[model samples]
Target chain A: MLSFYICLRKIPPMTEPRINPNVSVDCVIFSFEDDGLEVLLIERNAGQNRIEDDLLALPGNLIYEDETLDAAANRVLRELTGLKNIYLEQVYTFGDPARINKQKDQDWLHSIRAHPEARVITVAYTSLVKKSNFKISPSSFARQAMWVKVKEVPQLAFDHNALLEKALEYLKHKIYIEPLGYELLPERFTLAQLQKLYEAILDDHFDKRNFRRKVLRTSFIIPLNEKQKGVAHKPAGLYRFDKSKFHKI
Target chain B: MLSFYICLRKIPPMTEPRINPNVSVDCVIFSFEDDGLEVLLIERNAGQNRIEDDLLALPGNLIYEDETLDAAANRVLRELTGLKNIYLEQVYTFGDPARINKQKDQDWLHSIRAHPEARVITVAYTSLVKKSNFKISPSSFARQAMWVKVKEVPQLAFDHNALLEKALEYLKHKIYIEPLGYELLPERFTLAQLQKLYEAILDDHFDKRNFRRKVLRTSFIIPLNEKQKGVAHKPAGLYRFDKSKFHKI
Candidate 1:
């Protein structure tokens, strides 16, 4: 929207608190819903003066002089989408000098940044959240923040596509070793639902019997007495993640 | 030791290629030697006018404007310790606004850096090397680089002690899932030697029989037709890592 640019331009450069143009933080906030893995993205709407094409990107911004990288990531996510109190883990820092050298990205940067020529090295953070819990409200320069399916993510702004791939790889690897898969599921869940979550994240199909056998072997996934209440089919038993048990091992 | 300062001071600031003072790279290079897990550290000898106690820290320096983070890490490692062609993976980025806010660190920075007050966000890298393979010749401002046992590492410059701790945790976690331990061993090693390496890194004793049984279950460690020679103790059968088998899994 034109309002996004107008709002940014209204803030005089001299009056703004000094930001480290060379250092920024981008967050890949992922959620599992609609039978798939989805990532939060902000649509970069440059209005009428847009060059090349508009694109989507992770919620990100430069760190202020006094903020830590973690604080900056949380602040950026909150400022762009009004989402806060989410646990984010820093995954990687992409610091290629030519990361933002593409003409289209440079144009987008010029529209949004005061120092477009500064080499921005971004520290990327990834977090998983339940999609049903929070309402998406676009704020700051982001006019639209949406959860797009990971498989359907298009060509994003800057090096975001690459960042997304890295985040996905991290998520897939972490899901196997850590109890991170539970973040995307209900407090109590079925093995079928768990399989679907893994299939979405790993993009690989597993034999239902084998998947259950392997997962049940882990001490963290505790079987529960509860079952799916409203489903038409036979009710499957539920399971919950045993956080204390996981830590003990 | 004054030569270290003189060497740094010799580089005229104006003619120097612009460096990102706010971003740097540090390396935690680990090696298995002397019956313990060792880390490569450089002595920070701030000559005559030293305001604080001398410290040993990870090999690191600010990145140049044209380099990628990986390249900067390699450059920093090579420049500081005269070691090259080592594979380093980015583990974490330490970017607390107050990371280098300590008076001791500030004093040391004043003696070495052009912009000592810049909030440096260091991207830390970790690597494993065979201590017997390469000789370490301290270069740049580092007058003394040594392989100090991880257990004996002293208080470090900047936030390096915390960085080292994170790197150690990463190493401990990674050694379980990945074939990284091979990097710290010879081409052919005894099972006893392998167990010792694990004990040193994990800092826990494993029952000899159980450790052997667990490791032998893995397909990657191929039994070789070789054995230790000329030792006072009984000759132990040697085994080598199967790179192809490891990759296939």
Candidate 2:
């Protein structure tokens, strides 16, 4: 008679052939630029299954096994966009089965078929970063990384457009209570610029007097002795975010 | 070469498996009782290879193919607790592989091994319902269902205790803004009862006068011109929630 261990070993192990799928992280990095509130979009190389010669999409990559979700997101951001340590957050999980192969050319479908062992489930996250901080370079996957206005994001593949909309709504809600405006602004920015950022996000005009008073009332802004350059209008006073006061509220 | 019709049928056939094993949903339903905030707990049946005999656990089930996360949550609540149309929201996802088979019971491990098709990844959600509304009935897999005070909940099985703690914290944070207190209170309750509900959830002593003033300031409380009865103390004024103004803020 075989021993229990030997018998168990002899029995064909129930194989989890479905490769837990390669989990990837995608970042819809937003920045308030001179143009408007914009999201970073990267162009993907045109392949046999891709209809467009250069398809545009969000910057993201596959997560490593030994890393946490935040760590994976940070690594993907740095590797893809040369940006590091921004205010990143997990927004939502995208697991629609159709998202894997919705490409017009069926190139991605063929790629997935070629690597049967690769079942990739991507976790989508978003980051609000200062547009001025980084010099982005196109990785091997695309021609270049460019900031596109949020309103102008065109027919993106998969559920990216819906993801972007959710991120924008999250930002609007977050900005009301948290000091999220700092993520879009530089180390020193004028009160007008801050107001403009709010307007752009809320998509509504605010009385400058009321807006200034409300922001100042929060007691989370520091007056920096600086001014904007190359502006013909009256130079507005610069201010920086008071992290200590912001946390107290 | 095969004809076009034959090639179409044979090549790139849609053979994707419909059964997804790695996803499930667990619910933590909290109710406000006369004592304090309570959570619904169930006893797992001592069935084949199920080691958690007579142990307390949250009401949960595997996600179905034709349902959304919210729909699955509603189904679980209705099927397990016999309650419906309550306040429900997704809290977080738990993916720790060791969370399932932490006990070193060979029989339990064998049960899990037997079900090779089951790779459970649970997403936790929390719901708030009036304690009086539920009709407790144990399912085929459970021994019984009972409302256990959150503070008195025993060491639960499968990270359920941790999930309950997280849900309590989420409720505490949400009470300040969202109209979630109504979910726990009876349709008609006194001012003192409302204050006690807040105190129970926040776990902090609030000045009675101040709490009353703050709640009344919202103007979403309708004075029912009724008073508490069968009590050994002063009869407090009864009030009902103004549903139209509940979600205004």
Clashing pairs in 2: A21-A119, A49-A107
lDDT per residue (tens digit) for residues A189-228 in model 1: 8899888988888888999999999989988898998888
lDDT of 2 by residue, B1-249 (tens): 469888787777666423345555778998887778889887765556456454577887665554556767777777776777866787765555446654532343244334533445566789888777777777655667888888899888777788888888778767766766677788888878888888888887889899788888886888887888988998888888887886644
Q: Write the per-residue lDDT of candidate 1 for residues B1-249, one digit (tens) a residue.
A: 899999989887866678888899999999998479889999875655755457778999999999899999998999889899999999999998898888877878888888999888999999999988988988777878999988888888889999999999898878767867679899999999899988888889999999899888988898989889999998999999987777522
Fnat for candidate 1 (0 to 1): 0.92
Give candidate 1's total backbone clashes. 0
- Per-prediction DockQ scores? 0.76, 0.11
Candidate 1, residue B44: how far the Cα is off, in Å: 1.5
- Alpha carbon lDDT of residue A16, candidate 1? 62
Candidate 2 - CAPRI tier?
incorrect
Cα lDDT listed for each candidate: 0.88, 0.71
